[model samples]
Structure formats: C-alpha cells, structure tokens
Target: MATSFNEQFDQHGAWRREFSLRLKLLAEWLKDHDLLDAAVAERLRRLEIQVRSDKLMVAFVAEFSRGKSEMINAIFFAGYGRRIMPATAGRTTMCPTEMGYDPEVPACLRLLPIETRLQPQALMEWRMVPEKWTRVDLDVNNPQQLAQAFERVSETRKVTQEEAHALGFWHPETPEDNPVSDAQGMVEVPRWRHALINIAHPLLKQGLVILDTPGLNAIGAEPELTVSLIPQAQAVVFILGADTGVTKSDLSIWREHLLPESDQEDIRLVVLNKIDTLWDALSTPEQIQSQIDRQKASTADILEISPSRVIAISAQKGLVAKVTKDAALLEQSCLRQLEDALGHGMLDQRQKILGSAMARGVSHLRCETERVIQMRKRDLTEQAIELKGLHGKNVSVIRHMRSRIAQEQSEFDQGGSKIHAVRSVHLKLLREVFALLGSKALKAEMAELTQALGQKGLKLGIKRSYSDTFDKLRSHWTRVQGLIGEIQSMLTAMFRQLNAEYGFALQVPDQPDMGACLAEMEEVQRSHLQYLSLGNTFKLAQPEFAERLVRALSTRLRGIHESALGDVELWSKSAAAQLDVQLRERRQSFVRRMDAIDRIQQAAGGLDERVQAIDQQIAHLDQLEEKLASLAERLVSAGDTVAAAQEPLSA
Candidate 1:
C-alpha cells in the first residue's frame, strides 16, 4: 500500500511541530544562559516563523482536459466521496486556483476580479489587499453548497473582443492559438483571474498548498501564474493525457512554463494521466501493459528525462476508485503511486531545503554560545591553577601576582583604542553595503527598466526589455555580493587582531551566497520570457500592458532583493554580536579573578575550598558544552527523514 498523503502530511506536521518545540528549547537555553540579546531574539523569532509557515507547494500544470484537476481531486479530496473541484470532460477550473488552509481567516473562497489585470499591480500585491477580492463563505458541513460555490472558478463571462483582447484572452492575429471571439464578436474569459480556497482539509491545514493551474491559455493570460507561482512550487506534476500522448499544446506547456535543465534533478514529475482511455476490452492485459510502457518511454525520450520519471495513471478511474472505495480500481489507477511519489519526493525535498537553512542559522548561534562557554571554562581552569600556587605564597609574592594581572588588564584596556578604530571602519563598510542593497537602489532600477520596456514594441523587443529588468537586479546582487566580500574581509582582519589581543577566537563570517538569489532572478526572466510566447504578444506589445507587466514583475524582484539584503544583514549582526559577547566575557572574567584575589588577600582561611570551587565550575561548563554540542547536532539532523539525493524523478 502506498503511504497516504494525509499520513505523510501529518508526519510532516508532526515533524514540524517537534522541530518548533526544539527551536523553542534552543531559544530558551540561549535566553537562560544570557546568550540571546535583542538581535539574537529577533532572529530566533524569524526562524520560528519560517518553520511554522514553510509549505510544500505542488503545481499541476498541463494543457486543457489533461486530468490535472482530476488528479488533484483523486489524490486529496476523494474522502469527500465526490469531486470538490469540478473535473468534468471539458475545460474546468478556468482560473488558477490555490488550495491551502489559513486558520486566521474564515473558511471561504476569495476570487480576484478578472478586471484586476487592467491595474498595474500584480496578483501577488493584490493578495495583501483582501478588499479587492469577492469573498464567499464556505460551509464545510454543506459539501454540496461548497462545491457549487467553487464552480464559480470555472465560470466564464462573455466579453467583447476588444475587452478580451485588452485582458490578453483574445488574439486576433493568432485566433487559432488562443480564445477567439464568436459570431457575436464576444470572447469567453474566466470570470476570475485567480481563486484562493481556504479549507479545513487535513493536508492543506498541514501547510501543503495545492496549485490547480488552468491550461496554457489561462496561464498566458495571467503572467504571474507562470512567472512567480508555478516556478516556486516544490514540485510540478506535469500532467499529460496517456491516450493523447504528448500533444502539441501539452509539449508547449511543458517546454514553455517549465525551465527544465537537461539533468533530471529538477523537482518535477511527469504523470501520463487518463490511462483508462487506453483500456480496450479487445486488448489483453499484457498488450495494455506494453502500450503504457511505450507511451511512458516515448514521453521520457521526448521530454529528455529518465524513463522512470514518467508515471502513467488513470486519474478519472482513481477518483472513482477513491469515491467508491474500490481497492482494485484504485490500484489499477496507480493514484497511490503518484501519491507515494509526491509524498516521498516533494514533501521530503521541502524538508531538506527548509531544514538545511534553519540548521545554518541555529548552528551559527550555538557555535557562538559554545565559544563563550569554552572561554568561561578556560578562565576557571586558569583561576584554579593560579589559586593552587597561591596556597603557600607570602604577601610579597601575592603582590607580584597582582601586579602581573593589573599589567595584563592595562594592556587589554589599552586595546580599546584599536577596538574603536576597527569598529569605526566596520560601521563604514556596513554602511556602504546597506547603501548598495538599499530599497532606493532597487526602486530606481525597476523604475528605469519599466520606462524602457514601456517604450518598446514587438514581442522579441519587449521580452528583451523584461529580461533586462532581471539582469539589472542580478547586477545589483553582484555588486552587493562584492561589497559583502569586502565587509567579510574587513571583519576577518579585525577579529584576528582582537583574537590575538583579547582572546575572542572569532571565526571569520562567511559571505552569504547571492548565487541562489541570482538563479531565481534568472528563472523569473525565463518564465516571463515564455509568458510572451503564449500568442498574447499583441496584448503585451501594447505600451500600457507592457509597462504594467514590468511593474508587476517588480514585486517578485523586490522580494529577491530584500531576501539577499536580509541574509547579509543577519551575517553582519552575527559577526558584531560575536565580538561583543567575547568582550563581555573577558570583562566578566577579569572581575571574577580580581574578586578571588581580594578574598584570598583578606584572609587565607579556605584556599583549598576556592580552588575546589573553580574546578567544579570548570567541570560544570564541560558538561554544559557537551549538551550545547548535542543540541546543535540534533537541531540540524532531527527529522532528516529523507535520504540524500535520491533519483527524485523516478517512480
């Protein structure tokens, strides 16, 4: 039996909750030990939020009537005993629908007006302004009513050809390629540009977001669907009709929407859906099997992925099997296999990505704390060793020891001048970095690109201008990365000087990689480049829509820029905090040593007792160090349920 998506999602939720608890424990430990200052506390809060809100998004992209919606209904909503999403024979789910649960909001259906596309703001920006959406309350207890309410997503409006053309739904030059006007000069357009469904479904509640995308025409109409949403999904299940094989439209959707590399490591699955269409009574079981194999192999060859990556399944049959509780049909449908693939593939991939990121931050925090603890341990040991020698010493000898200690203190304090200089340079370098990555620079670049694109004409010309916007941001990142390198280099030299002078033993901070951010910027460019090819070139070729598209694309680029800034900002703060922590530790160590000497000077009654106390303190820190190490190890490795680098595309 395949592992239930519900069961797997629950497992992920359980794992996530446990991880959160551990993070909380780590935070508390840092607080209790006085390792968490305001900055550290803020970072901890962000980490917790990241863990809580992390979702495994799966995009089901395909041509019309490829069983994309049916696959979703079968894999997730079968327990409703009927299809929640209307998955009939024709083009249903006209708009791109996102299915997820947000308990903070009421259970409802929120639909963005199709007219919102006329505005310069993107769908992503529109999400923040809830008032723009048409809200319908969902009654989970009344499934029939809820299903009917959802049917609005597939509803279409008869728009005049001029209106449809303006919305990029009608193309007069390429009428055969997209939706065309009827004899009455009216074109059918999706009533809503996008749909947001919030439900109390178990899988959705556990942060599994299901993206049910419409066909290429709808995808082309809404550039954000292809540009931002689909590319960001943890996995994309490219559904194809098994009977139809790779149709022209299907191939177009694949190559166009998906920026597939030649390597099969991309987080995607090829599901040859509607295999039931191939089940002919005249054909033997062996013959049917042979037909399925050939199709899968042929799809793999054409798509240039490994053959094992292509999964053949009857989604229609799967839904029937699930709704009717027919085990044999369900097994034959291979819905369970797809479920297993998604569970093992997407969920686990999300875990690793999220876990690794969390681990980097938490580990850095732990290491800083551990360094302070080690310093405390070393101080105690030195104190104990000095006290042992002091047991039999006379007043003159004690005076000499105090003199040496005072001289050391004087030298350490004298380095304060050096500290001020290094700190001044550090602040200046940080200022330069922040200025380079400032929101002002980002806005200026976007505005410049938008103006340039708005002046352009033709699909190819406009696409180049759109791509130039991303390249501009990439250049910004490259510049920021160089500035960060300079910052890191300066900090390393300053820290090494301090380590030699005051014994901070600071490890030089690594410059955060802009590669990931740059790559994502490149991806947005590629997806939007395809967005131009959807035969909606005439629409985009318009100066107003062209400018609007660039402005909308700005939302995505802004996010990328902010993320890169945050990473660098965090590193800078961590680096400075490490120095402050060491300085504080050193000052405290001096105070304690002076107090011990004063006590011994006052009266030499219990020298052995003081020595023993210092030893015990050192021993306690040794135990604490072990615990801290264990905690960091567990935080990183906990819920590493996924194995390393499995052939993800394989069945």
Candidate 2:
C-alpha cells in the first residue's frame, strides 16, 4: 500500500524524536564542557522540548471582514457552545490574536493590548488583564458573552486622539516621520484604531494559531506584519471574493507580494471566497465556470501556476456546511480544493522536516569525525618529528664512523714498503670494512624505511565507508541546491515586481559562487605529487643487503611493524634525533592544513545559513514594500487636492 499522510507524519515524528535526543545529548555535553553560552544552551534546551511536543501551529491570514475568526470557530470548536473568536465586518482584529484548544476550563475571551511593537510576549502580559480599553476576559461558555464579542457596536473603549498618537495608530504626515508616507499634507486618523481582542476557545488551544488581519490598509500598511509574520508563516492562504474573481486589489496583492518569483516559492493557497454569490447570478453555471477558468488561466500566466489550483468557497457557507452531514455537497462544492491543498501542504512539510533533520544529523556526525581524525593526525605528526630526529642522529653516527676509518687508512698508507704484505692485508680488510659502511648499506636501511612509510600512507588513505558517506552528502546537497534554486528564482521575480511598484532598488545575488572553494580544492590536489616526492625518492634507493640479512631484517621489521611502521610510529621513536625533529615540524604543518580545511567548511556552512536567513528577510521586505507603496499612493492622492486648495489665484 502507498504511504498515507499519517504515515509520513509518523516518520517525521520519529525523526523529530531522534533529533531531540541528539540535541539533548549535545546540550548536556556543551554544558558539561562549558562550551556554549548560557543563553544558547537555554535556547537548545527549549528547542529540544518543543521538538518533542506534538503541538501543531495553524495561522489564519486574510483581509478584514473575511470571517477568519468565524471559520476558526466552525472548523475546530463546533461542539463548544460559544464562538470563541470575535468576527465582525470592517477591521475586527485591531491586533493579531491567537486561539487554541483548552478543555480544562470554560470558554473565555481574553483581550491583549499592544503597548509597543515587540516580541510575541508583549501581548501576553495584557492577556486577560482588565475589562476596559479593549481588554476583557469573559466566560465564553455563555452564549451572551460570545454574541457580545461579535457585535460591531459593543461597549468597547474609544481611544482618545492622544492615545492613538501615542500608540502609533495615527498616520504621520512628514517624510522624515514615516518613510512610507508622502510629503507633509496627507494624514488621516482612523476611528477604530487601537481596538484589540483575543479570545481563547477550547479548540484554539489544541493546535491552531489564528491571525485575524485587517484589510490591505491595516495589514499591508504596517512594516511589522509584512516584514515579520507572513514570511515566517509556513503557509499563506490568500482569500479573494468570488464575485470579484480577480479584483485590482487581489491581483495587486498577488503580483506585489504572494507570487513566487526568481528567489522564492513559499507555499501559497488562493481561495475565491463568497462562492454562494455565484449560485444564482445572472450568469449560468457554465458561463460562471468558464469565467473562473479564464481567470485561473490568466492568473496562472502571471503567477506561474501549472494546473490552476484556485478554490472557490464561501467562508460563511462553509461554516454552516461543516455541521450537517447532508452538507457534504455544499462543503465539497466550497472547500474540497482547499482541503486538498492543505493536505498536500502538510505532507510536503512533513517530508521537509524529516529531510532537514536527517541532513543535520549527518552534518553533525561528519564534523565530529573530522575533529577526531585531525587530533589523531596531530599525534601522528608529533611521532614523525621524533623519528626524523632519531634518523638525523643515526646519520651523524655514520659520519663519525667514516671519519675514524679515514684516519686508519691514512695511518696504514704512511707505514708502506717494508710492511707491503701487512699493507696488502690491511688494504683488503679496509675494503671490506668500507663495504660494510657504504651507500649500499645506507640504501638498504632507507629502502626498509620507505616500505614502512608506504604502508603508513596506505593506512592514511580515506576509508571506503567515508567515501560512501561523502557521496550521499553530495547527493543530498544536489537536491538542496535544486530546491534553493527554484526558491531563489521565485524570489527574484517577486523582488523585481516590488522594485518596479515601490521604486526601491533591490539587487539579488545570482546563483552563489561555489567555484572559489572548488578551485582551491583542485589546487591542493594538483600539489599532491610534490607532497609525495620525499617518500618516492626514498623508495628509489637500492639496498645492499645479503640475502640472509635481508630476510632477517624484513622479518624483524614486520614483527614490530604494527608499533613502528606508520608515520605515527616512525616519528614517535628516535634512532636519529635530528630526523625526528624535522618530521615533527612537517606533521604539525599537515595538521594545521587540515584544521584550515575544517574551518573553511564551517565558514561555508555558516554562509549558506546566513543566505537563507537573508532570503526570508527579503521576502518580508517585499511584503512591507507593497504596504508602503499603497500607503504612499494614498497619501500622494490625498495631498493632491490639499495642494490645489492652497494654490494662489490662477495666474
């Protein structure tokens, strides 16, 4: 049987568990070793806990009066008696609100105030704080309170002008005060600003985080929401009115912000809202369908959708359809496409989570192994230095022996003629003695050393398993590269549109340059021959050993080979102390080079991370650009009439 979405989710859960375990271990090690800063350690601990917890986060985003809150209540809290979230026409959510499933207590409406734009915690302090100033915690179990919350003209606090100005709810006129504004004449104070309500329903606490956004003027007008929230969102659902299949505003939003460009393709879903309006319009069903299809085709051409996956739905009707079993037809007609989109999105997310986790694990293991190997190399280098020193000392000893023999030969030459017979005997003996200490003898010893060195080199050759690991890593990287490329292309197109709309220049880096690093590696490989020259030279030497002696030495070296054959052992011991010192220095150089490579890898990885973060920030900036553009245009238009009014008498 094919794998189900649930099965994929389960696999992701298992990997998450593994990731949590590994992270826990890493945290503990860092703590014990005092390696990480306290704050970082705390963050890791929190992340570990979060990974293990099965909490799902679903955020709702739409223009004001799109019934986002109503949809939330209907889908998750139908059995609950009260409407947990307050949904009304015209900018209902003055601030972003979240709801979830909490069964331990009765339904409650908690209003959180926005004192300043800060972290998510800023709203938490005001949650359930008071009854006035748009702050209230009501018992939602009672239908009366739920109904009261939804009413457009409830007993809500009216903010004074001073309060609005203080809270940054008032529009700024000057260019210096607000970069998003036009020259100093167009400022309008909205009446319904600074009103925020947060409701906690039993269903909300379960696994949903709803963001009830205001209209284009509210959501797009602010840099905070555009630059922070939406880009970070896992999925974005754009709600459009079905009656206005693709309105100027809807198209504007898609073209300016949501559509995938050269640099990004973050998941986006579009819902043609108010589909019930299409049921009995003057247009026939076939005509309406054709219109929708045409619109879809046009949008696909602009936004790059392949199969045209727009869903036509009535948020108001879908809420009603959820309750009755007979409402399947209605529900299917309205929400089946959206359901499919959500399901596919969820499944893709699951795969991404698992894949990222696995990649992280492999990266961690590779780093650890590299560190260990470097340390071992260092130890080997130290030993090589010692062995080189011993070899030098042995050379010095041989030289001294040659000097002594020379002196003896000089003495023998001086006592000539009368001791001709003695001279001849001495000459023969001298020749035999010289032969014992000849270059041939030295070469024989050198040959043995070369063979030992070769054996050591073989040992140092990277294991086949490591090669396999690298191959897998490369394959994984290839996939990541492709995905990143697609995302990058999407972002590029989006950025271009934003630049054109807002008149702000944005230059995106084309495919990042990995060539420099690759070239460096190539250079290193090219120099390998020079690096191996010393060993090669030693191997070329001819050894002058008798058969018996050669056999004896080979057997002896083989016996102690495990201990003294490799570069580690060769450098560790000292037959000639000078040779050992030189070897030690060379080993140190090798270790340093390896360390450099490790640092380079780490730097590259960090660069990749930073690029990803920048991409996210850029997406946020694009959203902000759209909002600012709209506000600026409005300000300019508003200022035009005022300028005319202030003009002197016509010349």
Candidate 3:
C-alpha cells in the first residue's frame, strides 16, 4: 500500500521537476531576449514555488474509536513495523493531529496549549507564532521515544466545569454532550488544542499530509476545522466502526461535517473499520462474507452514498499483517482497496488542481511572450518585403520609405501618451476597488459590526451580525465588480482604438472573475448560518464563543478580501502587460525598418543583403517559436503520462 502511493507520488514529483525545468528554460530565454516583464517574472516565480511546495491534504475524519489512527498506521506507518500514532484502544487521539515533513523545520512534535482556546485569535494565527507552542524534539532512531513523543497529542488535563465551559468544551444545556465529571467536579479535556508532527517519513517528504481529527467534542469546538481545513482537503476519509455501526453521534458527525454541498462531489470514503469484529467462528467463511457485504450495503444506504464508496477494512488486522508480513491476513484486511482508492483520489485530484493553476499562470506568461515574438516575426516579414520591393528602384524610393517609417514612429509615440493616460486612470480605479476589499477595510467593517451587534440579544446579535456583515460585504462586492467592469471597459476601448488606428490585432482581455471570491464569502455566510441552525446555540450565547466565532468567520472573510485585491491587481497588470509588449514590439519594428533603409542608402546595391539580413531574423524567430512549442509540450506531457494511468480514486 505504501509502495504504490509512494511510487505514484515519486513519479509525480519527478515529472513536476521536469515541468519546473521547462519553465526555467523558457524564463531564461525570455530574460536573455529582454522579453520578460514584471508580471511574467512574478508568475514564473509563483509557478516555481507552487511546483516545489505542493502538498496533498488528505483528512481522516471519524468519531472516536473508529480505528482512524490504526488505519493511518496501517497505510502510512506500517513500514515502521509498529504503531506510530497512539492507536492502542478507545480514542487515542484527543485533539487534531497533522503529520507531514518539513525540511526547514527539524523533526519534532509541536503542541498548542489547550488554554490558548480562551483567546479570540484562531489556531491559524497561533501557528505562526513559534513561542506559543510546546515543541518536543523527536529522536527518530528510537521508535519508543518517537511513540512517547506522540503520546503528548492524547494527553489530557483535569479542569473545572467552569474552565471547560470557558474553553468551549462544556455545555450546561446539553449535559449529555459534556464530558463526564470526576468526583472533584473536574472534567477531562485535551491538554493541547492542536498537534503538528514533522517527521522524515518518505510519504510526507513526497508531499502527503495526514490529518487525524478527533471525535465530535474536539471538532465542534474548532470553527476553523469546518470553515477552512476539512473543505480544503483534496481527499477525506470518514471511518465507521463495524461494532457500533453508524451510532447517533457518528451520524451527527457525518451529517453535519462530512456531508458534501449539493454541487460538491461525494468523494469522501466511508471505511467500515474493525471488520474483524464481525468474524464468526461458528459460521462459514461465506456467511461471514455475507454479513460483511450486508453491513457495507446498509452503511451506504444510511449515509446516502453508493456502496462502492464504502470499503470494509480491519485496520488492526492490516497493521498486524503488515508488521508480521502475513499476506493472507493483509489481503483479508482489504486495506489495499482503501489505500488504492485514497492514493489515486488524493494524488490525482491534487495533481489536476496543481496542473490547472500552473497552466493558467504559465499559459498567460507564455502567450504574452509569444504575442511579442509573433509580432516581431510579422514585422520581420514586412521589413523583408519592403527591402525586396526596392529591386531596381532608386535611392529616392528608399528615402520615401524612411520618411514614412519615421512618421509611423511619431504616431506610435503619440499613442504612448494615450496609453499612459489609460494606465493612470486604471491604476486610480484599481485603488478604489482595493480600498473596499483590502484587509484593513474588512477589519474596520468587522470591528464596527462587532460593536453594534454587542448591544443586541445573543440570538439577535448572531443573526444580525452575520446578516449585516455579509450584506455590507456583498455591497463591497457590488462596488468592486462595478469598478472592475469600468477598468475592463476602459481597457477594451483602448485595445479597440489601438487596433483600429494602428492595424494591430490586440484582443481585449476578459473581465476579472470576482464571482468565485464572492462565492467564497457566500459560503462562509452559509456555514455560519448553518452553524447557528445546527445548534451551537449555547456556544453562541457565550460572549467568548460569540466573539471567537465572529473572529474566525471574520478571518476567512478578510482573507477573501486580500485575495480579491491581489487577483484584481494581477488581472489589471496582465492587460497592461499585453499593451506594453505590443507597443514595444511596434516601436522596435519601426526602428528595424528605418535601419534597413539606412543601410540600403549607405551602399550602392545592398538591398538584397539587407533583405537577407531581415530573412535571418525571421528564421531566428521561427526557431524561437519551435523551442517555445517544444518546452510547452514537455510541460503539459509531463503530467499527461502519469494522469492517464490514474483511474477512479477515493479517500
């Protein structure tokens, strides 16, 4: 199981390097030819970072004692010949644990204090601050020491009900949902808010992120998990215990968290774990198989997913099979099926996402360069034609052509002033768009809403805050959309005027799609409303939780603001880049024409030589184009080969 995913990932990474190499080749060529602009260079650098730092986020979500940790151990840490995560018995993972490799960070486990949950700041913000976490250096050579270090994730502390309630764990209204209190009236809660483990594991190095989420209590307390983390993961694995089947809590977790949006694909895998528990010695093997099949079908019907998405696997047996090298038990465990599904789904889906993003950026950069080079080629052909037409003509013909070229240069210089005026207006308008959508703008809006909402009742405050905030945000969206339209309209007019007057074929760039960003804002609002509907009732009533929820949701909305700003900036710049490339190419063409005529006038019959010189430049551009085509082909084909082998995959 490890080998298959590892092989696919290694192949993916190798070819990804090839993609980077091709980009480097094109970038160096552009730099050498002085065709690279700020936009193109920035895009090239972004693609480089993306290719080098791509990670597939595969989240394992399940209720407690669903063998999630065991499944992870079987699939990822089986090579260790022992359990890497604390999967000994009931609910070993007390908090959310993420495992991955980072060369920049040393091999260690970092735990954020559970006490930090009292703060309004989110886990994401805390993650950026090193001093806030308790870091434990891992001794990889010693597996026992490593396992002991992992135990910290499951560590718990006794806290009073008041403290737990303040930490957003205990609920007075839902006493059944609260943790059991001891004789001293103290509840057991996770000592840490989150765990981040950095290991030198090969799969982690291959860019596989393993997210191990705890049961309902821990997950419900973390708003970031639902609002950001889980949805963003490339693949999700929802495990269920064969012993308990889909218990009420399990159903709650599934319906509330794992359930997909209507438009979203139902890609999450439902693993019927602990299947070995169903093995009946008195019954025949066929009877046992019948029982397992029935369980799987029943689970599928209940979850409203196809039966094919549910895989019956014994994580404990699989782990043992792997450690003991028992092929028969390993096959019976059926971990391979789940592994293949997860491996292909995560790696391939992530590959497509990475490919599409890079393709957009790379294509934009390449096309811009191609446009400049193509224009040069066309100008070269014209220069050759102009020179060749002077076969038997006198010096007066050459002088007339030179004067016309000079006039054309002056016309272009005058057009430059118009281009500058448009660029100036575009930038001024872009600043207006940014002002409404920037982080500071979002913060200011949130602060005012927070202050105003505080005066209302808890329920009213929650509803009104979300309604008012999103309403104002949508207004900002409308304004940004209008400004973006104005910018695009202005640029479109500029492109058309330039083409009509200068005989250029400049296409107007499409308007920036602020729709996707706006939809993200809508998603956050929907989830917040859903959270309210799903009965975070008591949690919302509390001032701390109310404030935390606001801050968490606000953070996401603020991110969208900043993202919109950058995106609008990039789109506006892209349009300007196209114009700049064409204008420079046009100016160079006039220079080449004037130079060709100057050479002819200086010599007694050098028209043929001058035409030959122009022909050489045309041939050079042909080679340049061939090289670009070859590089582009290599970049696309690098993933195409690997992608063809990837069939339907899941997690």
Candidate 4:
C-alpha cells in the first residue's frame, strides 16, 4: 500500500528535526569562528531549536466585537459551558494575551503592569479578592481557581483620577492642566505587557499556543504589540466578519502591513468570519446563490484565491454542531469550512519547516568554505613577505655601486690635464661617429632593408618602430656629446691657468689609440657604428667585444646594468612557473567545488520537485475534505428537519 499524506508528513517532520540538529551544530561552528553577528547567530539558534521542537503557534486576531474570543472558546473547548475565554459585548481582551497547554503547572494570571500599586505576591492573591485591586493571578488546577482568576482579571471599576495618576496610567499633573468632568476623559489602563500565565488544561498540552490579540485599534494604540508581539508570531490569522464581507479596516490591515513583502512567506492567514448572517438575509434562493457567487468571485480577484478556498464560517454554530452531532445545524453554519481550512494550514506548516531546514544546511556550508578561504589567504600573505625583503636588498646594493662610481669619476677629474685630454678625444670621436652614422647613404640602405624585412616579417617593416628608435638614440648621443664638451671647456681653463703660472706649454693628446687602454671600448663603438650603417654585425669576436665593453663601462657607474638584466630574467621565469602552477591548481579546485555544488543543487532540486508534488496532493486532499464537510452538514440538517416532523406526530 502507498504511504498516506499524513504518513509522508510525519516522515518529513522527522527529517526536519534531524536537519535542524545538524544546522545547530553548523551554527555553533560559525559562532566559534566569529563569522556571524551575535544577534543573527542567536536568531539562527532560536530558529533551529524551534524547528526541532515542532511547536505550533496560532494567533487569533480581529477588530473589536468580531467574536474572536467567542470563536476561539467555541472551537477549542467544544462548547461555551465553562467559558474558558472571556467574551462580552464590548472589548473583552484589554491587552494581548496567550493560552497554551501546561497541565503540570499551577493555574496563574501573570500581569506586567506599566506601574503597579500592589506587589507581585499581593496581585497573585487578588484573584480571591478582586474588589480590592485592578488585576490578579490564580492557580488554574481546578474549576474554582479558573473562575477566581477570570473574575479577578475582569473586574472593571473606575479609579479616582489621583489613583490613576499615581499608577502612571495618566499624564503627570501641571499648573495649567484642567480636569475633564466626563468619563471619556478618564485614562484607561492596559492590564498586561509581557504576561506569562500557566493553565492546567488537557488540550493545552498538545503543543498549542493561542495568542489572543487585542482589537485592531487597541493594537495600533499599543507600541509593544505592534513592534514586538506581531513580529514575534510565527503565524498570524486575521479574522474579519463575513456578514460585512471585506471592510475598509480589513483591507487596511492587509494592504498597509500584512501583504507587504515579508522576509518569510505565507505567515498570514485571512479568515472571513461570522458567515451565519448570510443565511438570515432575505432573498430568493436564486438571488442568494447569485450574490454569494458574485461576492466569492470578487474576493477571488482581490485576494488571489479561488472562491472555493475562501471559507465562510459561523464560529458560534459550528462549535454547537460539533458537540451535538446535528448535521442540519452544521449545514446552516459555516464553521465546518473553517475547521477544514485550519487543518490544511497545519499541514502546510510542515512544508515550511522542511524548506527552512534545507536552506540552513546550504547556508552553513557556504559560510564554512568562506571562513576556510580567508584563513588560507592570511597564510599566503605571510609567505609573500620574504619576496619583498629580497627586492629591497637588491635596490640598496645597486644604489651603493652607483655612488662609488660617481666619487671615483670626480677624483679622476681633479687633476684637470687628464680631464681635458679625455674630453678632447671624446668630442673628436663623437663628431666622427655622428658623421659616419648620420649620412644619406646609410639612410637609403636602412630604408631598403626595412622594405625587405617588411615583406619577410608578416608584411610590416621590421616589426619595430624604426623612426622613434633612431630619434631616441640620436637624442642620447647628443646629450653625451654636450657633457663631454662641458668637461673639455672646464679642463682647458684649468690647464691654461697652470701653464701661465709655470711658464710651460702643455700639449693635449689626440683620441686614445684603439690598440691601447680599454681595447673593448674601441671594438664596441666600431662594431655598433658599423651595424647602424651596414645593417649587420656579422663579425663574432668584435660583437662579443662590444657587449663586454658596454657592460664593463656601465657596471662601475650603474650597478643596475647587471642586476636589472638578472632580475628581469629571474622574475620572468618565476612568474611563468608560479602562474602555471596556480592555474592548474585553481582549475582542479574549481572542478571539485563545482562538482560538489552541482551534487547539492541536484539533490535540492529533487527534493523541491517532490515537495511540489506533495503540495499538489495536499491541495487535492483539502478540496476533498471541504466537500466532505459540506456534505456532512447538509445530511445532518436534513435529518434534524425530518426528526422534528416525526416529533410533532409522536407528541
């Protein structure tokens, strides 16, 4: 045999319990890591425990005189014989209150007063002596205790203005304050704030918490109820009189507050109450049916529900019929529909629990992964510190070398004769080199080479910016010549002064011989100039000599020449290796994480599809339940009418 809906529901309930336990463990991990805020962590902890415990909280809300308390008493107690909840012509509940199962506890009425004249123990004793105080508490283990508690809390005697002011129920008196003579001017005191009363009842023990909220106006007037109680509620049922249909106030409740996009969905349930009035309205049967159809259609368009789902109920009649087994009374009443709707709603809650559990599991996993990644990043940063230190040391060594070379060059120039001679030779060679390097013949040869190279190198000229390169080289050479000229001029002046003082002619040497000191320097300049003019440096020994000379000259003056080249090669290799390894590792990690995520998503998807299927089944079952309840009411009503006719004959 296939599993029944209730059986499936029970299984899902059990799964949710297990899931909640796991989520709690995950939340503990998050708290340990300081990954969540304290308040958010606390909320998650509470939600986890709430899911595991599987408690159902039903709030009864409505405008004043809409039979909210009477309905709760009738359905919950099966009759008003004992009057478990106080219901009167005016507002019976002066503040928000709660009732639930706790039979092992003593009966008590806990009051949280804004200001109090009586002590806690004194208020507890006041149930037996209601005329002595404004409120009281009583132990509810017996009928006598229950009666006493109710009487104590319900006593409505007016207090003197002075008494009211003393209790903080009225504004403080002032010199300009005028006392009004009318009863309307008197300040009304709210009886409770955060009261917790224990009731010793059999039905209350079945995981039920009935929140009896004050009327809309009263709730609006109270800041605590609006800010705290309503938000704290896991589920809320808004009751409206069906006899009057949707009123401005009813629409206001939904539009202004309840129907907004809440973080949680499906928390609010709207109840069209007091539907028995429909039966008394005078009209032909056709006219009445047409009106009901029209009203239902209108409601469907407005509330986005099928007319059949909008239950029209008479709370008073349904409670009597449930106990009496009179189908006729039930048929004439709408209470049966309301009961069916509530039952369906309870089943729907089970789905919400399962969804929340799965969501928490996914969230926990993501948070855990993020925490681990952050820790890894910190470790990598510590490892990178060594690289920075090495770079700084290299920069200092290069700078020291450059300073030493500059000091040596200055010392060599102090004699004036060597400086004059070296500068004159350098200037002469520079002029000759420029004449050789910058010529029409060389330019024409370079242009032809460029054109030939362009054809060979993918149809572009040498794959380089020749004009910019030539301009930059010429600018550098010009600056070097100017420096050499300045040195020469200074040396000439110093040498002339020395010659005048000593009366001897000093002869400046010509350019240094290529075969003598710095043989590499002569080879380099000659080879480089040849390359520029002829477009090639094919001689092996000369080219090698050119590279050696350039390195030797620059090394003493700028240590960066050697270190820069070495650093460039080292960084390029290191970067390539590091990037390759990281890329491969990242690819593998990405694949692994993606696979894990895919599996989770697939599992969640399967669960979602199953849940949707179950939801459809549940909806079908609800419709059947509604139809069965309607049929039962009709049958009972017909039987009652037949019995009445037979009674007349028997009499």
Q: Compare the candidates by TM-score and give the number of the best one.
A: 3
lDDT assessment of candidate 3: 0.80
TM-score of each: 0.91, 0.43, 0.92, 0.41
For candidate 1, which ten residues in a row score worst on lDDT? 642-651
lDDT tens digits, residues 1-651, model 4?
A: 222223343444544454455456555644554444433354455556655555556677777667777677666655324556677777677666667655554556665553433232222233344344333456554555565465333333345665554442333423122223256556455554334456644434434566776665444433223323454355666776766666765664554334443434335666666666665557775776566666666765676666765655677776667567777886656565555455455545545544544454344334333433333333233223322222324445535534543563454346446535755564564454444334332344334433433342322232233333344434544454454345445545644754454222332212112122123323223333323232122211132222322222222212222222222223222222222333333344334333333433344434243334434644554553343334323322322232321221100
Tell me how many clashing residue pairs each candidate has: 0, 49, 1, 8
Reference-based lDDT, each prediction? 0.80, 0.43, 0.80, 0.46
Q: Per-residue lDDT of 169-191 in model 3, one digit per residue for the tens?
A: 89988888998999999999999
Q: Compared to the true structure, candidate 3 yields what TM-score? A: 0.92
| Deviation of model 1 at 12, angstroms | 2.8
Query: By summed lDDT, which 10 consecutive residues of candidate 2 come out lowest?
Result: 567-576
Task: Kindly provide the TM-score of model 2 when superposed on the true structure, using C-alpha atoms.
Answer: 0.43
lDDT (C-alpha) at residue 391 in model 3: 81
Clashes of 3: 1
- The TM-score that candidate 4 achieves is 0.41
Off by over 4 Å in 4: 1-50, 79-82, 101-105, 114-148, 151-189, 193-195, 200-206, 246-257, 261-264, 281-309, 354-651
lDDT of 2 by residue, 1-651 (tens): 233223344444454555556556555544453333333343455556555553444455665566566665554544454454566665455555444445543444444333432122222223334453343455655756756754432222445444434444443332232213235433333333233333454323323344555555444333334433454355567766656555555554554345332222236676666666666658887887776666566655555666366766666665566555446654535554565565457545643553444344333322332332333344444433432333324435545544544564455345334234533443454344333334454345535443443343343342332233234323433443454355345445644653454232333333433343233323222222222231222221222111212232233222222221121111111111222222333345444434433433344434333334434544554553343334323322322232322323211
Residue 113 in candidate 3 has what lDDT? 95
